[model samples]
Target: MAKLPNGLISFGKNANCTLELCPLEASILQYQPSIPGNGAIIGLFALSMLIHIIQGVRWRSWDFMICMVIGCVDEIIGYVGRIMLHSNPFSFAAFVIQVVCITTAPVFFCSAIYVMLSRTINYLDRSLSHFNPKFFVWFFIPIDIVSLILQAAGGALSATQSGSGNKLGVRISMAGLILQVVTLVIFVALFIDYVVRYVRKSTARPLQSRMKLFLSFLFLSIVFVLVRCIYRIDELRDGYDGPLIRNEPLFMVLEAAMMVIAVFCLNVGHPGIVFDREPRNDAEMSYTYTGNTGAMLQPKLPSSSSE
Candidate 1:
């Protein structure tokens, strides 16, 4: 690899560069991606994906399972890209894989969350919600899809270009992240409002232990994802060569660890654990507390109408 007049190694899809030929600082990331760290992340996401498959099968939660599985796979592939970058940071294929996969992966996860909230509203009391519970699904999922497209497109565009074109890609990706943040903020507000309304209802029963646990972990997962999005927006604001993007520790904590915790929290807060046996008709479902166990008992529907 030959150095340009600026004393930096020339880099591009056509560049023939390797760690042996170029200094680490000359790589786009300015440092080697750690294999050990990324490998551990892959292992964790793989485990979570497996668990999600089993849980989804057992409880018949196909949508949730599919979202989680896809998200985990995306994370795994993205980390594998990082591992490749460890060997040769100038690898354009590796750069594209990590950028696109990791950035868009969370869109699937957010879709899952959006669906769950709708289901939860239906499970609790749809009447208490400001808008139809179905609104979450009909509105948010499409928004997530838009965000996914922008981020993926931006990453691909950025990776394949240089100069001003690269900056344009980063800006587009940043726009996607900003949209996601805005959506989450709106979601949190509606969620809190609904919870407050539900609690204040005269006929409402106190949440059972299982319900409490599920809600707690679900909310925690949302927080983790929100924090990660904010961090990414900041990291990408200055394009690929930004200082925040170069800071591996911040990336590990805010991006990698936050996602790990969020995925696990979803596992713990899985709606199937509580709602699997409940009536599928969100409006007609009724809950009664069993003695001492704090478990919700749903009245069985007639055989002709059973789901």
Candidate 2:
């Protein structure tokens, strides 16, 4: 039996061992992942992906639809890894798949949310925003890419090593998770600021009921994702063998349930629902500013000539 520097047995791809041959504690996770729980999560994500595909095509929201579908697919694959882990807790391939896919899936989700904010800002009043609407896409998307790279690299590194070498990979992954949390915090702050400014500076009519509902659900989705990111950071803080990582129930609640709610919330608040309406003609779209009052005449169609 080969042992690594960390005093744990080296169970790499070639390690010939079974649950009966070795103690359960010898496995990296020390327990089999729950098949039923992972399968349920996969089903939910698949359903969300299907709905997104339909909505995106119908509304012509190509970018949002693509991002969401990819994220859901990534999530499904990650959970499938967990299901594989249930059959063999020491499976290195399963560990790598789950770690990399699950860690990076939210980056896609965040990118989708970032684009929505940019679109929302433009739809409302771009002038009220502190930065250009395109800035959100250009800046945040690159940051998300960086986070994804770091997490994927870390997972790869961990899969290739055994024992104490795993700590370095965990640290790198933690850095990525921390960056994600910081990014979310900044994004939420900017979103709040934009909303406040829009409320104060615009003289437009109050938001319609549907728009109000859309905004509410969108914000809730961000909050749920933020909560999940925070939980992941804490879970990885103590490394792979940490207590939190070993706690399957907590993972189900914080990671799985949080993501489930976040995705469903996006479905309810789909941007296309509000932004895909028929465009008004130029005559009905004209605006006349009321000087210094921050007000403008609402656009309306011209009256009939006979009248």
- Local distance difference test, per candidate? 0.83, 0.80
lDDT of 1 by residue, 1-307 (tens): 2354434343667756677766777677887889999999999999989999999988778888999999999999999999998888888789889999999898888988888777777677777888877788889999999999999989888887888988888888988999999998888888888888988987776676777778888899999999999999999877877799888888999999999999999999987776764433345655532221112345655457657
Pairs in steric clash, model 1:
none
| Model 1 TM-score (2 dp) | 0.89
lDDT score for residue 257 of model 1: 96
- Candidate 2 to truth, TM: 0.88
Per-candidate Cα RMSD to the true structure, in Å, reads 5.5, 5.5
Worst 10-residue stretch by lDDT in candidate 1? 288-297
Give me the runs in candidate 2 sitting further than 4 Å from their true place. Answer: 1-10, 278-307
Candidate 1 regions with alpha-carbon error over 4 angstroms: 1-10, 278-307
lDDT of 1 at 290: 29
lDDT of 2 by residue, 168-225 (tens): 8888888888888898888889988988887776465456566677789989999999
The candidate scoring highest on lDDT is: 1
Query: Residue 104 error for model 1, in Å?
Result: 0.9
